[model samples]
Each structure stands twice: as structure tokens, then as C-alpha cells.
Target: MKKIDRNNLKTFKDFLIVEGEKVNIVFSTAKYDRSFNRNNDEGLKNIESLKVDFNVNEVVYLHQIHSDNVFVFNNNAKEFIEREGDAIVTNKENVIIGAFTADCVPVVLVDEVEGVIAAIHSGWKGTFNSITKKSIEKMIQEYGTRIENIKVYIGPHIRQCCYEVSEELKERFLDKTKIDENELFNGRNLSMERCILEDLRSLKIEEDNIYTINLCTYCEEEIKLFSYRKSVGTYGRLFTFAYKK
Candidate 1:
């Protein structure tokens, strides 16, 4: 896969390609706030710029509630509004589906063979509930996506270096993921990456097919990514999306 790194966005080419058809996996930086709730003129203008930049007909974003619900968009005319779920999957073309996040993990899953794509907003709750596995299962059941053919991309988020959680939360995550506490924890700081990797590997997803950007959203400065922890709950969200052409 080819990676195009820019000042405000990161694009992965060929990661979701099939038979010369290409899909762009984009992760926006803080410079481009793509929050879905913004209704100001500037917000509309920003969305318009995104449309022009990606050459997509529509942009479907989620109303994330930190749940494990995965909504499937089948291109129905009435399903045009913001979907209420933490993950979204679709097989339609020309519509870019995205998830909004500040400190939560932004994941994009692509079944290159089936031409199916999914976006997941996985926080502690979503991760504990095995949202990624559910989304993959949904794709397999609904869109004929095979586990072996799926490619996973994990974007920037709060990592273990600074993600200090309570003892109860840490224990719950450890129990759910069944990861060794020593490997998944640095003191009270839990490694979301390790838990996610363990869960993915348990589903028999190949390690090579999984790609992680490995940037910590809470402390990164180069790209100026928004971090919920860093901003104390008042922060602009970063938009990560996948668009196929």
C-alpha cells in the first residue's frame, strides 16, 4: 500500500483496492475539524471542502454513543441522515462513511475482495464489548465479507503511555480481552493497542494485514490531533473515513 502524508490528512492508497478500483483511507488532523455537530457556516464550508477533496457524492457520519451497535448502510434513500451507532459498514460506492473521534480509537476495516468497508469508533466501552469482532461478523453475514480477506487500519488515539484508567476498568478490560495484565498494563495505564491486537488475533486476523499508525493522540504535536483527555472534554473531533472509487 502507498501512504500519502500531508499537513492535515493521511491517505492510504491500494489498501482497499480491488481489480484496479481504489479506495482512499483518510485520517484528518486537528487542522481540519470534521465534527458532525457543527452547524455553523464554517462547518458547512469545511464539509464542502471535504466533498470536493475526496470527490464523493455524499458523506455519512455517525452519531457515536460508545456502543457496540454496527449500522449497515444499504444506500436506501431514507437512510441519508446521521446513523446512530458506533460502527458503520457499507458496500455502496461514492459515499464516504466516517466516524468522529477525539481520543477514541478510529478503525477502518476493508474487505478488499468483497468491496465492503467499515468504520468503527471504539472507546473503552466499545472495545470491552468486542465491537470490532461484531462489525466483522456483520460484514460476513450481510455482505459476504471473508475474515481472511479483510484489512484493518487503526488510526491515532490515546495510547498506554498516557491512558491511565481506574483499577476497575483495567480489570474489566483485562477480563474481556483475556490479555495478560503485565503485557497490557504499564502501572495503571492500559494499552488499548494490546487489547485490540489480542482480540483481532483471536479472530484469526493475520498480523500483517493489520496496520497501526502508532501515534498517541494525547501527546502528538506534529499533526495537532485533537485529544479529549488533553482538552478536558472541550475538543474538536477528528474525522477518519474511507472512500472508494
Candidate 2:
């Protein structure tokens, strides 16, 4: 776990977490707009405030096709790439990687020894495709990072109690992977949190090293966490970002 720094936030927020020499976690607790929720300046400002003092290389994001395609940012090619994908890993200390979500989980990874970090978007579709495992695999292959030294954070999002899905979605999970029948749909597995935990345990991410926010975006209006389902389609996005200082 990282120490709490009350001075870094730009507003009244208890959503961000800073850890040791290698990692920081930012959890956004609100939706900034109503029309398709396109306005996210507030969240961006809050995210940027945490970046102060970091070398800050190119930040990474994806169109988030909700697949298992994980990219490694070893070279400068992605600097100009505009396409969206599910995951991104970087070896550069200054590079910050982030992913946006209103309800999806922001799965952050850091290679403590190598200073490599990844910000991942794990919607239900991505989890079915094994996005988490793939990101860990990409880091090891591209940066020689060890899964043991990597610090993992599963930030706030929709939790399982509120994540119940329809019969169609439940069936979809059964058809996709080896995941247990209990994890899926409208109020099922809760997408990001449970799936990330499953991946960590499966990949040996260790229960001790994994940290979670355990927040259900849909349940809390007081904290301001975004909830697409709660907002009934019109919801603004919140960002999850990390950079080296």
C-alpha cells in the first residue's frame, strides 16, 4: 500500500492512492457530464495534479475494443498511434499509462524493479478474453519484468453485488473461458475487481501485493464515482493514470 498524500488533490477527493517509489492509484468518484458524458475536464485535472514531479513520458490509452490485445510501449511508435486497444505496458520510468472508465475497473500494474507500469481497461468482454494475463505476459516478454515484483492495484468500479447481468451475459461467460459460473452479468462477477483478482491468483500475483478500492460506482452518489448503469446511459468518464516522477 502507498502512503496517503492529502496535499496533491485539486478538490475534495479521497480517491487517489500513492505507493512507495513505484506506483500511484487514482480513483475517480463522479461523472462530469450528462450528454453521453463526454465532459471529463474535472477528472482530467484531478488526474494531472497527481502527475506533478514525474518525468511523465507518453501517456497511453486505447479505443478499448474490449479484447485481449495488450501492447508494450518499448519504442516510440505508439507516440503517434491513435487506435484504441485493451492494455498497455511501458518500461520507461517517466511514461504514465491510463485508461478511462465510468464503471469498468482500472487495473494498474507496476514493475517495481524495472519501473515499468501498465494501465489496463477490463470491461467484461476484455476479461473474457484474458486481458489481465496478457498484460502480465507482455511485460515479462518486452521488459524482462517479473510478475512477483509487480505491484497490482484494482481500483474502484462496479462491485459484484451490483454487477448482476442478464441470462444472455451469463451464458456468454460460460461459453468464453474457464471462469467459474458464479462470475458474470448485471450483478454477477462485477467485471474488473473479481476478474483482476482471479488473474492475480491464477498468475501468482499474491494476495498481499494486490490492493483494491472495493467500491461500487453505482451504489455511492456521495463519493461521485461514475456509473453508466446508474446514470442510465448518459455518463461522464473518470480517468485512472500513473507516471514516473
Candidate 3:
């Protein structure tokens, strides 16, 4: 459990050392762009950083669609082409799982014993579709991963402190939630992020299995993150990933 502040953004690193496995979950701050076709400058730098500790060639990244589609890389890409998916899981060692986000929640999951990891991009659409549950189900069904042993690291995104939405949107969120939403926000809450976590909880995930990084990309947009809502335009994306070798 460690937080790294770089380029004015909060990058999370979850190191896993067990059974001869060296796995890590790394997240990018909003300062990086999400729409990279190849390994952009920031992406290259991030990959290089990870390579210093892992295999750079084994890293995999997705072309993040807001939808719930997930893709598992076989390390068969020509250069670094982005795909149209929101999640990726792999049991292969040295294969990295990467996702992009600016204000959206970028989630990373790891099953220590099985040595399987997933990198996810959980946007409003993804959360509404329950991408966490989908990813967990995929792990269990496709990779023989035990849900109880899953450790989910929720990376930095727009926090509730500044995640204010209209009353109508809030009500729509509340309508979908079974838990009391009254105390979720001090004065506001990030409905999308909260929803994703609840979705995982509903899937029988333990409370301790979930970890959240309380960094707000919107407010800290100029500091170290790239915020779509704050940026007011389409631009680069952050490089958030989970790599194991």
C-alpha cells in the first residue's frame, strides 16, 4: 500500500511479492493523455519506468471504450496500438494490463496465488454496466481465480469533495443504490466511483479487498492530472496500468 505523486498526479503502486511472482499495479494521473494511438511520450516514459523494474515488451495497453468490453492481450500487438475495450485480464507473467482515465476510475485487480491481474477503466457507462462485477466474474470463470482472494486497487480519480452533479442525476444514482446515499458525501460525492465499488461489493467482495485512492483529478487538474471535465476539451490521457513479470 503506497502512493506516488508524480507530474502533479497521483500514481498508485501495489507491489505483490509471493510464490516467485513480482506483480505491480500502477496508475496514471490525469496529467497524462488517454487517447494515445501508440506509446506516446508519456506512455513511453511510464513504460520505461515500469521496464526498469519489469519487462517493457510484455506490457499491454487497451484502447479504452467507455463500454464494458474487456480484452486480454496475447502480447501480439504491432507496436502499441490501442484497442476498443475497458478492461483486460491476464494470467501470463510479464504481460502488463493497462487502462486509461482522466476523471474516470481506473481499477486494478490482482489474485496473488494465481498471479492473475486486471486493469480496468470504469467510466459512468462502465459503472452503470457493472464492469467490476464483470471483470471479477471473468477472472473466476476464465482464469480460475477465487474472488475472495482478489485485491482491488482503485486508483485516483475525481473525488467526492468536488464531484457535484445536478439533483436529478443524484436521484438517478440513489434510485439505483440500495445503500443509504445520505452520508456518502460531505457536501458531494462521485456517484460513478461509488457505484463501481458497490457493484463489486454486491458481487461478494470483502470490504478489505477494495482500496481507494482519494485523489481528485478535477480540482488537481493543473497539478498532476488531466481532467476532461476540468480541461473542457478532448486531449491526452493518463497511463494507468497493472504489470506483472
Candidate 4:
């Protein structure tokens, strides 16, 4: 098992990869000199460059629809399908699974004991629908992954400090989870982390095994992380990926 050096980790341009017991995780930021948006040709080039850096044969990108749908990577398939889903899980090595997000939560789950990994995109809608929980259930059913042995990482996103929501949205999240109104909505904004953490704990994931970057994409101006809320309609996306190797 490779121990992760969280304090001494390095970044390649705006990309950062962290090693774990059985999986390698990578995250891309908007801080690079060039554009790292996954919506254009330049973004494709940057993604290819990351593939080399991570030493993965291919990177599977999802057609995210903010739905609870989870795609299970089938390496035995003849063709690579870009399916519409919010999360992906697989046991295949050397194939990086990834998702794009501007304000949504990018979650990576690794069952080191079972050698299974997952990449999830959890926006407000997806989180409300319990997408992360669904993905873990899928892994457990398909890969025999034990919930307690799974290590989870919740990447940067729009935190409650900057994620103001409408009354209807707040009520919907409240109805979906056990989080209190005060913690769920801080007078002006909704707490996405609180809701997500609650959902993970409900599924029996140990509190200590779950880690969060705790950085707000909308609050950190110096980091250059993409934020749809802050940029309005002119923002790019940050990529989060994971693979077992």
C-alpha cells in the first residue's frame, strides 16, 4: 500500500494527482497558463497531456446529465461508449475514469481492499437524488466492495458560503436528507457538503475514512478553480479522475 503524502504532493501545471493504497486520483484546475476547459479542442489537448502524465491508456469522459445514473466501465467491450451518467465505477487498471464540474461536487471513491474505484459528479440535483449513495451501492452489488473499506474524497465545489439557493431548492434538499434547515441553509446559501456528508454517513461510511478538499470553488479567487456561479455563464470546468493501478 502506497502512503499518500498530502502535505508534500506536487502539481503538474494545474493538475494534481494523489496516490492511495490501491488507486490514483487526479484533479485539474483552471490555474494553468492555457485553457483546461473540457468543452473545446484545447481542453481535449490538455486532457491528453494529463493521460500521459497519469500513465493511463485512456481516460473515460462522461456525458453528465446531473442524473443519478451510474455507468459501470466494461473494459471487455469492443467500443468505448461516452454514456450519459453522473458517476462511473470500474475495476479496470490503466483506464482513468473522470467527470467535469464547475460548481458541482466531484467525488472519488476507492475500495482499496477490493481494487475498485469510482468517479462521481454530484450537482445539487444529483446529490438530492442520492447519486453518491447509488454509486456505492452499485459498487457493492457488482464488485463486492465493502462500504467500510471504501475511501472517499469529496473535491472542491461551491460551499455554503457562496452557494445561495432558492427556497424551493432548500426545501427539496431538506426533504431528501436529515440535515437541519439551519445547517442545510445558512440564511442565504445551502450547504452541499453537509447534505453529501450526511448521505455518505447514512450509507455506513466511516467519518474518518471520508476526506474533503474543503476548498470553495466560488470563494478562492487566487486558485483559479472554475466556478459557474462566480463566472455566471462564462466559466470552464474542472476535471476530477480516478483509476486503479
Candidate 5:
């Protein structure tokens, strides 16, 4: 993924592009807080402006309760706003589907062959419940997308270097996912990236097809993104969206 000159949104330049298909993965910085939970009017207006700026037909997002729910959006469905879910999958063109996050893992999946895309927000709760796995399953079940055709992009989030969790939560994640303790946990710190990658691998997604931004929301040196864990009082959200047209 490459950051545009504006720096507010980052787009994938050479990944997931196919003949007659325009696929874009957008990653928002701290400047664009597209969270509708507070002051919905401004947020909705910003979304409208984003559609014009990004050249997308529509923007769809969810309320993001940190659950494993994946909302499938077809072309015939109504405009989506503040629907309760943690992920979104769509096969329609020019429609941007996304998930909001502040330090939580933001993942964008695309299958150029099938013209399918998904955006997922997998926090500690969502990861434990296998949200990414469920999102891919939804795409396969609904759109007949092949697991091998999908390309996964794991965006910026709070890394294990600064993400310290309690013993109870750590143990639960280990026991539930059966992920290697050494790979996922460094003493008491947990790697949300590892959990997400492991889940994708279990579904036979090739490692070469996966690209990780590797920018830590808590400690990125170049750009400072929003982080709920490191914020003093108020924190903005980073929007991660995928578009296929």
C-alpha cells in the first residue's frame, strides 16, 4: 500500500488490480475520524465527501460492537449507516465497505477474480471470536470466492511492543485459538497480527498473498495514527476500507 500525497488516506497501488477492475484499499490517518458514534451529521458529511474524493459510488460501514458479525452488502441493499457489526463483505462495484478502528486491527481482503472485497475490525474480542475467519467464510459462502484468490492486507494497529494485556485475556486467547505461545505472546504482550495471520493461514491463504503494513498505531515514527490505548482522554478512529469496481 502507498500513502497519497494528502497523507489522510493511503491506497494500494499495484496490489489486487485486475483487468477491467478497480480495487482500492483505503487506510485513514488521524486527520479523518469517520466515527459516526459521536456527532453523526459531520461524520456523515465527511463520508459523502470521501465518496466524491475517492471516486467511489457509496460508502458502507458498521456500528462495530467488537463481535464476529460480518454484514454482506449486495448492490440491491439499501445504503448502510451505523449498522451493528464488526466486518463487511461485498461483491458490488464502486461501493466502499469498511470498518473503523483505534488501535484495533484493521484488515482488508480482496479477491480480484471474484470481484469480492471485505473490511474487518478485529480487536481482542473480535480476534478471539475469529472475526477475520468468519468474514472470509461469509465471502466464500455468499459470493463463491475462492480462498486462494484472496489477497489480505493487515493494516496499522497496536503491536505487541506496546500492547500489554492481562493474564486472563492472554490465556484465553492462547487456549481458544491454540496459537503458538511464543509466536503470539512476548511475555505478557500479545500480537494481534499473529492471531489474524494464523487464522488466514488455516484457511489456506498463501503467505505471499498477504501483505502487512507493519505500522504500529502506538509507535509509528513517520505518521501518527489514532490509538485508543495511548490516548489521554479522547481518541479518533482510523478508517480502513476496501473498494472493488
Candidate 6:
């Protein structure tokens, strides 16, 4: 099998790509490209630069609301519809499907055999509502994706070390997962990554197929990743994108 040519682009970090597969999974850093501040003109330029670098015809994303809703892209759609959802899936080639996050988990799911991919934004609210699980289920239902054939990459987010939560939120997670309160929450913080992984495994995704970048946005200030908890006044958001060539 041909090996995947990992791009060492200064703007983004290539997270996961299978040998001989047409798909590419990548997440932007605070390095050369700083599209995190999406409110200004520079942010728009950064996004355009990313599309150029990735060589995708268009970058499709959602106006995320931390909901469990997943939208499937229609290749023939005229203008990109600004939908309020948390996930996006598409079998359409050469178009980047993505999500923006500050401290929320950004997940990219790929079924190489079926040439289908999905991008998910799972914050505490979305994870609580089982958004990742719902997105995978939608992929299987609509695109005939096999659970075993799917590869998942969970990107940078706020980990338990830096993600402090209220007592009520902690109790809600405990009640939902039925895990012991102490096990789920380390003192006052909750690991959203753990909750996401548990949900993925519960959906029958193989443990080995799931991968995580393990970088905490809130903790890694030197990396300069956008963190909502760290700085909420900024309108910056990290853009994670995936596309099938």
C-alpha cells in the first residue's frame, strides 16, 4: 500500500491519515495560520489561505450551537447554508468539512472504504447530549459506514487538568454515565475526552481505531491555542478540517 504523504505545513498539524487513503485529517495551530480570531479581516484571509494550502474547493462548516444535530452536505447545493448544528458529514470529494472550537473537542471520523467523513464539535453540552455518537450513527445510516471500518481522531480540547466545572455539572455527568462521581470528576474538573471516548466505545467503535491528540487548550498557553475558558473576551476559534482527495 502507498504511504500517506504527511504534510509538514507550518500552518496546521496533520493528525491522522491512513496509508493509501484519499482522506486527510488536520487541525490548525496558533502557528503560521491564525484563523482563530474569525471576527476580523485577517481571520478571513487566514481561512482562505488554509483552503488554498489544503487545495480544497470549499470549506464547509456550521454555526455551531453545541447541539446534537448533524448535517449532511449535498454536493449540488448552490450556496453554503449557515446552519446551527454541531456536526457535518459529506462523501463529496475535494471539499473540506470542518468545525470551530475554542475548548471543545473537535472530532473527525473517516470511513476510507466508503469515502465518507464527518466533523464534529463536542463541548460539554454536546457530549452530554451524545453528539459524537449521534454523528457516527448518522454516518452509518446515511452512508452505509461500518463501525469497524471507521477511524476517529479526537483533537485538542480542555482536559480535566484545566477544565474546572461546577458541582451541578459534575453530578449531571455522574448521573448520565452512571460512573462513580469521583471516577468521572477529578475534584472539581471533568474530562470531556473521557466521556467522548466512552461514548465512542459504547457505539461499538474499536478501541484501537480511536486516537486522541491529548493536547489541552487551556493548559498549553505557549502553543497559543484558543481557549474559551482562558480568554472568553476574544472571538477566536480553532478551525479543524478534513477532506477526501
**Against the true structure, whose TM-score is highest?**
4
Model 6 clash pairs are 36-237
Clash pairs for candidate 4: none
Query: Candidate 5, after superposition: displacement of residue 222 in Å?
Result: 1.1
Q: What's the candidate order when arranged by decreasing lDDT?
A: 4, 6, 5, 1, 3, 2
Q: Candidate 5's C-alpha lDDT?
A: 0.78
- Candidate-wise lDDT, in order: 0.76, 0.67, 0.68, 0.81, 0.78, 0.79
Q: Can you write out model 3's per-residue Cα lDDT over 1-245, one digit (the tens) per residue? A: 33433433323342222222567666554333334324457556655565565555566766676989876555675443466788988887766667767788888888887878888888877876788789888888887998788888777677777777777766666776754676544444645666877777777788777776666777764446767778786565665676665
Write the residue-wise lDDT of candidate 6 on 26-89 in tens digits: 7776654365444578866766666677777877877778899999997643354367898999
Which regions in candidate 5 have their CA more than 4 angstroms from the true location? Answer: 1-21, 31-40, 75-79
Candidate 1, residues 104-175, lDDT tens digits: the string is 898889887889999899998888888888999999999988889988888888999999999998878777
Q: Which candidate, 1 or 3, would have the higher TM-score against the true structure?
A: 1
After TM-score superposition, what is the CA distance of residue 157 in candidate 3 from its true location, in Å? 0.4
Q: How many clashes in each structure? A: 0, 19, 15, 0, 0, 1
- lDDT for residue 96 in candidate 2, whole number 0-100: 66
Q: Cα lDDT of model 3 overall?
A: 0.68
Worst 10 residues of 2 by lDDT: 30-39
Each model's Cα RMSD: 4.0, 4.4, 4.8, 2.9, 4.2, 3.9
RMSD of 4: 2.9
- TM-score: model 4 vs. ground truth: 0.92
Query: Candidate 4: what lDDT?
Result: 0.81
* Order of models, best TM-score first: 4, 6, 1, 5, 2, 3
